[model samples]
Target: MASLNKHSIGGNIFLLLLAAIFMLMGVYFQWLYTNESNAALAEEIAYQKAQEEYHDSNIYYEPEASIRWLLLRQHPAGYFVPNPDLLFEPTQLNDNTLRATRYAISILYELGALDSINPKTIIEYVMENYLADIQSAGEVDGAVYHNGPYAGFGTLSSRPAAVRPTMDALLILNLLGGLDDPRLDLDRVNKFILAHMNDDGGFWDEHYAQSGRNSSLRCTSFALRALSIIQGHQKKGFSTSDRERITSFVVSTHDPASGGYADFPGREATDSYFVFRAFISIWSLASGDLAERREYVENHMEVDHTIDYLFGQHYLKDEGAFSRYYRDLQSVSSLKATNLIIWFMTSMGRMEVLPEKAILQYMMSKQNRPGEFGGDMYTTYSALSTFSRLAVSTEPMSQPKKPTRHASIPAYFPLMLFSLSLLTLITSYFTKKHEMEARNHILARQASIDGLTGILNRNGFEEGLEKQIGQAIRHDKPLALIMMDVDNFKDINDRHGHIVGDKILKEITRLMTENIRVYDIFARWGGEEFMILVTEAGQDKAVQFAEKLRKIIESGFFGIESKVTCSFGVAMYRKSETIDEFVHRADEAMYNAKHSGRNQVSTVPTSAKKDDRVVEFKP
Candidate 1:
């Protein structure tokens, strides 16, 4: 070995010093992490201990006092006092109306104290405010659409028609044995509700419809319950296809991840309110006992997962209540959350899953005046109803096992993440930009799909048609257009109903889908009509396929009395002709089939002229 130079020795000393500095920094970070973790863990442990102490304290559910509070909400004249803020003050013109009246009566009925108020007086008030004379009914409401002679109540006394208020009135009046009252027209009411039931199997209030919003579960529940009460049967009022559509809508609203039903399809449930309404709508749709009801619900949603969810994600020990949302328990009202949770539990018939002591204590804490729960009538009704349900359950109380979470992530995690992600974020910027563009492309593609049948709509088909025409022209390739429409579809709709018509359309779509080649483009062209573009195929191949589909359609039943059949017209593309002229020839041929007794395949020969016109072909 050679003797070491002074420069080498100096380099070694500098490296050792750098390593020692790094070690010291590592030690400092560890101390900071440990200190922060201990503080959070201690806080968590303290919160858990406090919750335990609260749970140990005995709480009582008072019956007589609750009845008294509900009674206090009622005026001496028998209608429920409208405002809890002012007790019995009718602040608005229609303040003493059906909403408070229904909730108060419902609460009293739930608590087994319906006899506390005179039923005759309540019915009289409901009739005075809600029931309207058809011919002599006052000026029509511009905000709502109401063809008179239908039974429904407006939001206000002067208002003539609405869905929710009508539902409340129906239940209240029926509970008081006012169904047989001559002033109340059950026939018109039935028609009124059926009108609100959209093809999607959900109900819409004409009031909310002004905002261009679709159906919600709350309104759907009201419509279903109202129709049931009107028909005096659980499941007889709705048609088979109508029931199918309704249940399908309910299924669409179920959020698989949260195991709760949303306000509408393709959404996570936001609160217990939405969950409660969803379950109620499903319950009202089912026509049997508990097991059958469970089965019905299972067909639409994940029952076991939902039942398990109640004990998992939402309940928190520190809060000692089930939070309104599954992901958020902090910074929420314990009173309303606990109350709504109990209500939802009872509605789903899963009250057995609840931790009895915590729910009751939290719920009862909202009652300050003998018990004026929820500051208003709606929540009051919810709380009282929950108490009644709980009074009957024999389930044991046990703390819910909280979902697995990081119990002690370092409090300075955000700072660490910021430092760690700087380099990654810089590298990922362009990648993220490309990802957003791809997402936008996919969204644009999905927009062309039909909402009902999941087929291409007319607009999408036309878009593809232009592209295919361009390709055909460029390569001088053969192409054909086949247009088909269901024979006597309007007659079928009149005989069966729109629901049956929609189902038949879907069935026809499925039949055609199975028979067509993958390259062939099939689309729904508005009502009862469909179009297909056969690429690289002349009129002969297109007509043969059309005839084949027509036979298959006639062979099958499409949820209706008569067998469904299609009339088809096939036209070969002329290399010299425009798309409009090519399409017109197909339309003219299809009409020829229609005029010559339908369910027949009619084709324009390859020799047909580009400008030939069929005089009797009607659109």
Candidate 2:
């Protein structure tokens, strides 16, 4: 009987071995069928050299369609517009990863790619996969969830109290764009933040870090930015006095001498990013003090010296660092830093209401492969968002154009493709690759523009608008200009504080978006200032539209405690008017309304008298 049992066990083991071999064979065959066969070392070498030979220029995206095509194909889950290689990689999980996922989804939605995925599904996925993990770590005040494995699995004592993740979580909740699903827990997030806010009005990561410890601009900026979003989104919950206190704290944190804001009220590591965040937070709320601080950073804060300082820290590799101040420049991973920088530049653009074109071009030039740039998500987002925001800036760069059969090959690479019958089959593979790439480019461009405001930003506005503007002039179409300014904007900022002021502006942006037709263009031109372009609209029509916009703005669906109003200026195209000239005329008209009693429209012709320049209404 024992012999029989041993023989049976041996037979079973033999069967198991056979099954394992078959499974291995199946996996190999399936991989071979669906994907490219694994390249042998020799083949890989030859292919890489061929790719290099094929790409004459070092610029990855340009001149070589095949390479660009190959890189883009790797983007899984066609969602958030994938950044390029050299940026940062997304981790599978973290302690507060749910919040990061929320922010990522918002970015994708903001970019327009979120349409492909169900918002509910994505939200649920985050809640299940990431949020549950966060909740398991430790709860904060039973309401705010803190002490997570998101950053890392360190005890609370060992970790730096980071306000960025929490703030970001709040902003993500705001960006969910109004489905009051209880899963978001916005009130809980706010309460969490408020509980963390030190007596000094700045927020710290934990209760221990809340007192006497130095606060960082990185943390402070994220906290303020997040709080500003909260203020805009959840207006009723935060009291008027609390809003005032927050605003006052934001103002006080500004470094008077350097104009570069510190991370917290007292610490002084004035960085471009923190300064930018400070300015943007202020700009979003229209806090003149914050705007003034931005100007100080721009005009007074030495860029060259700061660059030198950063360079001195050995942080200026192909990829950049998250922060640098002291001689001992401690570094964070590149992904976080990259986004912070990109966001900083975007904020600066908002403050100046102009494009940082040259800087942006340099950043774009640094984009590497497959939606990554300069070694992390932070820098990649920074560069992309900055580019998106500054699309209309008067910076000179090469315009994007569709490739044609007649298009000349880049002068460097001749005889790169030997047009043979067998090669044609190989070339067909490349052609399909190129087509996929072209589709992605289109999708990515479309996703990045904001839908409501016909202006290019946060998605679709940046790429297309420039092409359209260039095409319009090439085709000689009349372009009408309108500049609209929110009246008593400062009053709103002061009364309700910056958060409600932001909501008011966002609502006004929505209104302007609704009023403009398909042929027209509108952008959040500056803080509480909007610019509109009407194609082929005559002076009479422009004036009429301006009046209508003014009336519409005055009607105020913003629904704050008090009524809001706007003043507008209209300018029709002139025979030889520059973009700047057109904008200036509209600006002058807007100023006229400001000087004239507020909430009125003024249409200025190209040729207006000096006295007419400052048109005054009856008191």
Candidate 3:
């Protein structure tokens, strides 16, 4: 009896232990399954939200018919006159006329109307007539100038070389590739520009000789733009410190109270022209911190009275034209002032806030005929540019196509699986759940990040670049892009297995990430190639940054014993250039760096040179 009782007790204890183990297994599997399912759903929701936001920010627009109407005002001389009313009449040309011509050309270029007009002829004429050799007593010998009596009756009169026209000519020539023409001496032009740098590091206007070294925002802005162009072309114009001085001078002109830039430090009144000039100068030169400058502008713009002054006081409600000043309404609205206002507003990315319909109506009213905006060349040009900028049709923003849904599980599967032992069912469920979670994580990561290096992939890099470009354009700030390629990467992969090559890449990425700023974007553009977008950095700063990156790579080591080096190409975004063009320039520069002997940094030339290769600026 004693033996039988002990046996029964042992059997009971074993059964209870088995049941407890099964229960524990079931609870663990349920927890794993629930956590993974919730995680996947959350990730999908977040990804969908991100996709929607991206699409919303990428809306496109079709330009209106008014831009085409303005093109008809082109002059027979291949330039545009201020008024379409003077189409058949001979017109006098001055700085305003030249500037109007530049604007017209830019508009036509933007509108893809090159088929209708011969820009080459217009460019040739400006280069031939406006290019002057200044040999004055105090000026440097053989200094080239864009000669003009800025306000004049006609082209018949000879005028002294002035800062405004010279700067305008330089900007136009740079934009139209006139600087590359052999007929125009870029060296002399460069010298002429260098001569204008004042003791205060700002530029002087036409009266520099008599003005006693005074600097005005207008002249300084023009000079900086021209210099920036030369720097792009020559890659040797201004030093980092020199650029800093120029930027400092421009920032000094800012009116903290009015949120407008003054002509000079002591001047209290703010004008649109001065403001535009100041903004462009900083944008082109990148002399100061861009984010800070943007903040200053934004703060002032928040309460800007210019909009009220422009629309309320100077606007011609019936005529749809804007006058130059609030006090004067008798004369025709100033075309120069109107154009400046449009450009300023556009630069601030505040175009949508203005009365687009009224502005367009006024622009159309100025047209004398189909494809012609009638007024003086300056006003006509202003109206055309304004129309081109504002004429766009908005459409509903579309979201990106959603990712395909995962396969649904069978409803009866869990019940059927329950027929198996508790431990077996729990093991199967946990295995499937773990697999699903790993697969989802990989899919999500692979979309925007490089699989090997764990950095941003090409798609991610492009998206980031697009966002940065938009911000730069909207705020009138500078942006720099860098492209780097690992030298002899193919050879490295061939000599040492691909696994080793990948290890090197991962190390390189880690090293670069540590060296760059927190905001700077570094991405794996492709196998053995990488890209970086440095916001608010000018060409000079970009070059320096690139050089730093190059050195870091050259000096670093991977787990294997090998010396690795990278070649870098840098480019600053140009105003009005498409994203493709901007990226192409950087890619070209990177190629130049690679071809010119790997492990060096090169920059895109401001103007296309004959060889299509940008000469390395040693400074």
> In candidate 1, what are the lDDT values of residues 310-388, reduced to their tens digit?
5565667655676666554444654556666676566567654577766666666677666567677776676666667
TM-score of 1: 0.50
For residues 1-619, write the lDDT of model 3, one tens digit per residue. Answer: 7887888777656644554455455445555556666666777897788786755444333334435555566766666665576666654455456667766666656556655666587776676554344554223324323341122011212555555666666666666767777666666665665566766668876534565447777778777777777777877646778767877777777666555567787565335566667767766664335566465455434325545445655566766566654333353565566677777677666664566666665665566654445544455556666755775433445656655544254334444444345554565567668988999998877888988888899988888889998899999999998989998887789789899999899999999999999999999998899999999998788888889888888888776577898888888887788988988888888877775767889885344546443546321
Q: In angstroms, how far off is 172's CA in candidate 2? A: 3.5
The lDDT of model 1 is 0.70
lDDT of 2 by residue, 579-605 (tens): 567567878877777656668777643
Top-scoring candidate (lDDT): 1
Counted clashes in each candidate structure: 0, 30, 12
Q: What is the TM-score ranking, best to worst? A: 1, 3, 2
Candidate 3 versus truth, CA RMSD in Å, comes to 20.1
Q: Which candidate leads the pack in TM-score?
A: 1
TM-score, candidate 3, is: 0.43
Ranked by lDDT, the better of candidates 1 and 3 is: 1
lDDT: the better of candidates 2 and 3? 3
